[model samples]
Target: MLPFFTNPYPDELLYSAIARYHFYSGNLDCKDTLEELFGSRSVIPSVEIGSNFTILAEKLGHQYSVESLLTNHTIYPYYASFLSKQRQQEILENVKGDGQGLYTRLGIVAGGICRKDGLYYCSTCAKADAECYGEPYIHREHQLQGIDYCSHHEIPLRKYPKTNDSRIEYIRFELKHMDLSPLYEIDSHKELAIHLAKQAYKLLNLPLHYLSREQINSKYRTLLREYNLITSSNRVRQQEMYQAIKSTLPNSFLQRYESAVNNNDEYNWLRILTRNLKRHVHPFRHLLFLYFLQYSVEKLVDIDEDDGAFGRGPFSCLNKAAAHYKKFIISNVIVTRDFKTKNLIGTFTCSCGFIYSRKHTTDMFEIGRIKAFGDVWLEKLHDLQQQNLSIRAIARELGVDFKTVKRYLIGNVEIKQVKSHRDNDDILGIYKQDLLKEIKKHPNLSRTALRNKYKKQYMYLYRYDKVWLDEALPERRYGQNTIKKVNWAKRDQQYVQEINRLHQKLLQSEKPIRITISKIGKSLGTLANLEQHLNKLPKTNKLLNDIVESVKDFQLRRCYKIIDDLLENDQEIFLWQIQRKAAIKSHHFHAIQPMLESYIEMKQEVTNNERTTS
Candidate 1:
């Protein structure tokens, strides 16, 4: 063992501590020092060092487990909360064995390491470290990828000039040895950078417990529901959720982290988070989601065992007269299952007679629909009335309508209940005779026609007097005997003639007009009828099919034409010009790129040969 080894600084990486040890001990040879500390010289030092914790502990004459190093020094806590106990164990085993192989599988580099390209350090921390410990050291938080600022100081982190690309294997470079450049603080990104830094710091420093994938998924779903990003049946409003996330995070921050969700992509990280937890996501991505959802690390990791139908309650009482008004003591939660919609309706009630309900799926809750205020809320108007306050004044004070204040003042504050279908049966019975007379007067009229004339009566009869209504207005039968026959042969000949005329017109047109079925069909409104009788209109079908072009074929033809025109005009044959003229989407340009290139080469060769002959 070495004569002396320094204990790791607060939030300092194990590798950084080892590097500091080498600096203090005047150990110039990196391979030898690594062999002495880790019992093997084959180990490569990474930003997040692992595997040799036990060996290092043994060399230092101390007892320490791999978990202690991971928790106290590395960025394990950020990922630990999202991983299952088994997965966490696997990570520990991988780190203890190969060290670097598990990072990719764990999604650490999923977003790609574009922003964090070097060894970063906070200048303030570097100066403080030099002053206090007589030498500057590398901080664990500073080394975290995508973290650009110091969480404590809120200053931009500076990167070492050549430490990241140093040729010396396992180089023990301290902060004092390198020339640190000052990082300019971007005002707009400062807040976001600080937030990211703080979150990253928490992950590196905190001792977070392991949470299962199911637990994390549940939390995300709950947040989505609360944000109204999901429907009653638990279907995600993808567009809305996308828009919400876009609006929540700044474009610069997203671009910096490479976590921006594209509008056209069907699958994105946000959507992936909502899916089943079979795959592990990157810890940075988890942080992004948690930040977007406004969930702190503590809230995310702490799974509430009592999250039942009414567990979210102790919801504020809506009834103003109740002693526990807005005190969140109300616990009357009734869950009603709607068989037709397959929806669960949760009705929350208070002792003071205020009630509210929401429709949700079996596993989800519509928290946004949880209305605490009820008719009892109007009781506040009573106090205003006693004070002789104007309706407008009361309305403004309570943030309600003046009309509502007036109604409550007149003692018309009773809550209105919705009338059920059964309750309307009596009213329908009164109009039964009138509905029958109207149907008889228009016996030739169809059910839809009759319903239009007597909408309310027809709806009631359709629901209650179905048998009578069906008898009075029987289903219309258009059998061969009753139906008007069409001479399809004659219609087919006429359509063929029209199609020929249109085709001739298209051929005669001088401009580059696209000949599509829809364009021809629009000119001939009876094309839908012709399409229906394609078997009988074989001549017309053949004529239309001859001119029809698939989208790819049409785009390629247009592209060729555009290139030919450009060549004839002696203009530059640019890809953008071809794309714009052909109306081809940018994504499809690559598919036909080789063909275009070959054609361009051949045309240029022919032109050169003609020029040489001339």
Candidate 2:
């Protein structure tokens, strides 16, 4: 084994420790360090989550294991807490191995939250680190993807310079890269940023798989109901929720982290967070939503699923026969929605076996119906009958009507004559006659029209005489049925033609718009068809796969267009001027800066050569 290794500082990344190891070990090449630690020089050191930890644990001796390093050193727990237990286990196994599909599994690559291009460190933390350890090192908390400030000091984090070959090199904090000066100029929305940073830090410290996606969704629904953002119909007021969240977060802060809410975009993170639970959402977006709800991460997880629609339980039992009447002893409540009215219906069950339902059309609790009076009420009725009380008196005692008391007494008769089956046939015959008469009067009426006109007769006949009802109704004509097989081949050709025209139009437009399949499909009014059935449209599918552009490409196109306009007007060009005209965000522009500079230089050279020739 090697001579010794540096113990990781609190919240220090395992990758950062390895970089420190490389320095102190005096290895001439990083490959030698990698070989010594992992027994494989080909291992790629990742900033957020490194691979081959099982081997590294062996090299680190007894003090470090794969689990300990993964828990305290890496940022895996932040994502793990929101993922399924099964998925967390799979990710843990991946971390133990070469960590293939690790980031993709964690949803980092597709999470839509932009990660920092390089390492980040708070300047104050760096100074303190240097003083304490005689050298500064990267902290895991500072490197979180969307967190801008240090939670401890509440100061903005400065990004460290990235190595030329990050795939092969592990960067440790260096004094040359450190700046000790305090930043007096504060960013806008400092309070919101600090809150988000603090929440993110809490998530980083949470245990593995602390909360499942279902639990998170339940908590959000509870809060949304309390905020009165849920409609009476049980649907989330998505537009209002989006507006509220937008108002809480400044647009600049959102744009900086690439978490901006677009009202027109139906699949935005806020909408998805409210509805879909299967998809793994980034923890940073979760923090934004929590901030909107004004809940800390700890409190949010602790909030139980006491859906506010029915309010918290220990609801009053409506059983009048029992001594516990109107007392809050009924702890079990089952909430469901009315199919026809879309109103929430709460079914409260008592331990005494009485069950009653109430529809939450309003705050008042009016009994919609009593499902079961149970044995307690039944025994109470028998006792009142033994006292020889009148039907009305017993009804008053039992909290039921006289007709209900009489019906129950008659229903309890031990030896009653059974009614003949033909007694029900007589009722069915009356309904059947009415249906035939209606059909005879309106010969041209289809089944639907007939059903609507004579709904009661239609329903009675439908339930009891379904065979006869089907025979009596008009036969379904061609193309009347709902399920019609599509001629996919012909439709595919038509869509391909329409999409090709739209694609050309998009390309030739003066404004630089990102070429995405969704954009093309939405323009064609076939977004759903394209998204779900594109594989069947082979030509369209291939074309979309080839033509779609990344956001960076679209930014480049906008930048080049601005440069061309400047050249055409014979105006002097500058990087800041190009960026302002392009309207691309600063951080995003930084990615394409080198290419933009080269393009401007090339254009200048062409102009100079033309002037010389002239």
Candidate 3:
């Protein structure tokens, strides 16, 4: 009296003593038994099978028609993968029952099994062989553990997988988050963008083989996860960069370009950035690689080309990558002395295919002014070379992602280290054989006792001599010292040698100027003549002859103003008779202000004086 559905196979099931094959192992009227069993027993099916025999043929993996074979196995008109015309002819000859089966072949997407309604299910979707979960007996209970389920399909969906390939792909799919209005991250180059969209259509929209459904589902699941992470993170960073750059653009971001001021467009800066991206080597080098990846890709079943082998030599992946990023060399960039003069302008093409020019000039004398795109990339590549810093330290110092730093460092440096595994350390051989002899002699010696015995007595023997131990052990010669006395003595000698080096350096240096307390007064008196007119003073102009050649003579004359201002600061300094009137003066000040009480009196007196003088 066991239950009818006792031990169901993971994929296939026949109800025996308890919903298994032994009960109906004889293939006893599949149609009639199902009908009788449904009517008699209240047993529920975990999976539902379809009614049509043609569907049964497909679920069980037998070809029924040409269309079914082509779509199901990825077989095609001429350039097909799975089945040839001869195979199709054989399938038609062997598996097809009648014209009725061939008529139903048009339905399968990537395969001939449909589980649209809640009754019929594919065993791949369910845990049963060729049973439809979405149709009549769709069981949500059969969904995979730890995942949300389609009530229709009754299978667990893949959420995450433990692999790098899946992780990167999952980030790529989170791109739906990038749907900020109508803007799109067209790949670094528009051509790559166009090609990628096509690949996206093929990969995302098309279905995989029914036989490979497990593989396909796994791949897509991983892709979705990676896509989510990549798009979300990059979109956030891009938003921040856009906001930052927006503020620094011209005219409160209303005008970003020289032309924007003329045209008064709000998005002129964005337009300019887009135009510059098309022409710039910075984006284009990355662009070409993406473009090649897209264009060179074929279906997974396509033959691997000999010419496309990666990491070979000469015309290998390295060479092709180098050639791919080679720049269009433009020469003889002109420079002008004045910025406002006619100069070479950086040219750019816009997204709408119009050229924009900006006022920029390349220095004719500067060496790296006219480098190719490949040259600039090579310079960036050189930065990853191992010079002084460790990889982690370099990444932290440069403020770049660890992965980005690791990519370059691994490519340029790590590979070299791995190839040259040359370790030249001394081998102080640890012979465990010596310990076995002591263990045999003293069977129960405690670890401390063993150590004391080995050191005190064994060391007194020839191999580990006590005479040598007395000389080696610090307690015998220099007691109560933390560091070994010999090591301390050596360090002390090094310290003395360093002191001698510093003394020699001090002797080599010239003696500094000695300042006497009396020299301060004499220096101030002589420094006053420096305040006189340049032509009146002896060699005042010659003293600044070199300085005046680079800067104007007016600037040289201003140097004397330093002395004039300093002299004015001293109240004890003598003043000369002035030809000007009202010459009563304050020290260090250009002029004295009249008091508030004397203001009106001064105005009246000054007016009277002017009138009297006239």
Candidate 4:
């Protein structure tokens, strides 16, 4: 039936665009489209009216006459660009001659990496400075084939020449190492997926109509099992039962529908479906059928059945029954990690128009529980400790906590764990060693990177938020410890920083080390003599060992002396200071160390005495 009409566009192009849309939806009804266009506030009116626009207004709303569509001025700009010489050249070179298939023809991997054309790779290139630079060539792959050299390095492509076959093999070899799902090993997850599919079927189908409890059980026997939500079974018994019940429902049931006008014509399908559901089934009860349907259709298949295509009037009341199933499929399914907090989240909406949402927190939650649960408990305890306002009063004002506030602050609360100040993918030892080297050179680097570097021995660490430190300095517990605090403290910045770097070498190390004071002063970088430096060693050998054994040896043993005159002023001379070196703490130091001169002589004397005794 013709609904309404309106002239909404000014140009031929605009009318043509509307025609194309009608063609796509298979709807020639211009009335509905015009009605929607007129109803919206933001849709703007076209500039001027022409014959094309007039024809669009009067038509069956089919696309502009096919003849007019072939030559529209609106698309000329894009087509015009194709005529350019440069563009034509590019098209010629890139376009394939014999089209295998548009999709299969163009590929990133099939053409690019499979061919073994010799190419430059920075990682495998000659690293000039490292000892391996001149060493015998070691192939990154197939080392048994010996040095696989690229031509760019001025080296001959090894005994094995680079070939397309080799390149394709390499591509496949590299691809084989990709991490893939271990689903093949887990049987339970797949079983659960199947069970959920059957559940989807129940949720999607039940809204056909509502019935009383006794009628539902006697007529639809399986409805009771579905109603209780006992869905863990590997099988669905309700499909057969529901089909039987639906077939037996009498036509007189339409009399139960509330709408009086819809008795003969102008049927309100949604209203009738709701009426049946209210009378015979659980409200929103079709959600079970929807879940089951979702579960059964494996990842590849989609359900497109339209049970409610025709209104329930004279025949096919079952189709009339299944109409109101759309609303149950509202939210997209969210699958979260096992941890309550997500390391990853998978969100999906299936093609069946049925939404299955669940939060799955994987093992990461267990790890967080280990690290964060204690802190969370402490936070609860602290909140409980502070009781200036009554919990009820606080809840009234802030809208959240009476007990929760107390729990997070006073009881079993998780602490706000500062993530470990380390990078997971950092070049491991290289990063730390490089940072120590940087600090040695640029000890007073004001803007050095704090993200990956730490200053050792003699650095003054100050971030923009200026709680400052230089060599074993005491940090202030109160505010104003960072750069933000120090900018205003014209005089205190230097002094506060001096105190902060004081304990840079705080951790105790297990290795014994010998400090050659004479050689250390050889560079004589600063003006200290061997005697002056050695004089700073601790009074007892144990004290000296403790000082020297620390990870930061030189600074801790003597640097503290300069800080508070920790050394009581006996600035004499000496050759060297000796302390144990760091090695695997699992073994005795002597057991692992090379025999010393003193140990060798002791061993020789013991051997002679053993011989005499024998």
Choose the strongest candidate by TM-score.
Answer: 2
Tens digits of per-residue lDDT, candidate 2, 480-541, equal 67688898889888987887888789978977778897898788889998899987888878
Could you give candidate 4's per-residue lDDT for residues 1-614 as a string of tens digits?
Answer: 22432211221233334433434444444444543433322232221111222233235345443223212312111111112233323322322121122111222121111123332121223233123322222122211011122322322222223323321111111212222221123332333333333333222223211222223222222322323211222122334434433343322321222212232232233222222221222111222222332323222123222111111112211111123322333233333433543233333232222122222232211111121222333433345446576767644443334675556545485543324346322433454455456656765544335323454312422332123233323222443655452232333343223322322323232222234333223323322522453333223223223333433444334332232221134342221221111222324333323433344345456656887999
lDDT of each: 0.69, 0.83, 0.29, 0.29
Runs of candidate 3 with Cα error greater than 4 angstroms are 1-55, 58-614
Error of 4 at 454 (Å): 31
Candidate 4 lands at a TM-score of 0.14
**Backbone clashes in model 1, listed as residue pairs:** none
TM-score of model 2 vs. true structure: 0.63
C-alpha RMSD by candidate, in order: 12.8, 11.2, 38.3, 35.5
Off by over 4 Å in 1: 1-4, 22-29, 52-61, 112-115, 164-168, 175-183, 210-213, 221-230, 235-237, 277-282, 288-295, 298-309, 312-442, 447-614
Tens digits of lDDT, candidate 3, 1-614: 21232232322212111123223344343433333333322222222111222432343343233344333322121111123234334434432332233312221221222132222222333333223322111222221111123323333223211222321111111112222122223222333234333332233223323212223222322322222211211121234334433443334222211112222442332322222121111111111222322232233324222211111112111111233321322222122222463233433222111222333323211222211213323344456444666666655654344675677655663221111123211111122234446666766655545457555343333343335433323232223674542443443344335434443453343431122212322433433333343345334334334222222222222322332333345322122211011222334122222221243345446656887999
With candidate 4 superimposed using the best TM-score fit, by how many Å does residue 509's alpha carbon deviate from the native? 66
Better of 3 and 4 by TM-score: 3
Q: Which model is ahead, 1 or 4, in terms of TM-score?
A: 1
Per-model TM-score on C-alpha atoms: 0.56, 0.63, 0.15, 0.14
